[model samples]
Target: MKEKAEKNKLLIGIILVLCIVILGGVIYFMKQKDQNPDSAFKPDLDSNAAAMEQGDGEDEPDGIRIPGYPSITIDADTTDVKMNLMNPEGNPCYFTFEIILSDTNETIYTSKMVEPGKAITNVTLKHGLEAGEYPAVIRITTASLEDGSAMNGANVETTLVVQQQ
Candidate 1:
């Protein structure tokens, strides 16, 4: 009985050592990733989108499409809009957004240097728009996470049906 207990104690000790070693390795890797933001290789967004286009000759997304940005919203003379941005991958990304009025091909809003994982709640639009259906487009450009090169761009077309409150 004594010998059996001793063997069990040794086994437990070995397991504890292994656990500690694993924990240390995990911490070390996380630190390394933080220190070297460009260590991971992210596929070029343009290449990926181009490949998809060539595959079936169909339009596909390049950067990760953010949710909650409805294709359409009624401005109703609202002053500001809440735009959101996010970086789905582990790398940081720079974004450029523009709002264009399709009727006149006028760029109503233009914003550059948006960061990752953020919501732009202070976006404002010109009020007193004539009550009617207006077609607008939002163009988004994603730059390289490492070097801020032009990676990919896409457009989100939406219609605003302005009505008096």
Candidate 2:
């Protein structure tokens, strides 16, 4: 009877240790995830007033409206790209645009958080590319308007055309 009691206590001790280790691991991972910068989109609370003034003329849609960009043009000598990156007034969330080079999987440009009814007309690339056409992706990361939390997003494939200045 004494031996059985000792064995039961030992089993309980092992179970408690396992539970503690599992709980600690879960907590460690949760903290790591929260600390990761790319884990979620952090939104800019202030809306772009200038962009709001330059509205995209269209009736409000039923759902989130993701503007399409089939191509973008830029001057080879300069980093300024002529494109309208907008989040229509109809949308209920914020938008962050990332222009990534397809060939090298490099992000050339990342826009600030854009609110609904606003647009980003002028954008400067990270670096100037040579005069040529390059395949790229416009990765749109959306965030919740109410809480500024990460939300659904979209990727629009486009051709980045660099013209000789």
Q: Can you tell me which runs of candidate 2 are displaced by over 4 Å?
A: 1-42, 45-49, 52-59
Cα RMSD to the true fold for all candidates: 13.9, 7.5
Clashes of 1: 0
TM-score of each: 0.51, 0.67
In terms of TM-score, the best-performing candidate is 2
Best by lDDT: 2
* Candidate 2 TM-score over all chains jointly: 0.67
All candidates' lDDT scores?
0.61, 0.83
lDDT of 2 by residue, 73-144 (tens): 888867876778888786888889899999999998888788887787778888889999999999999888
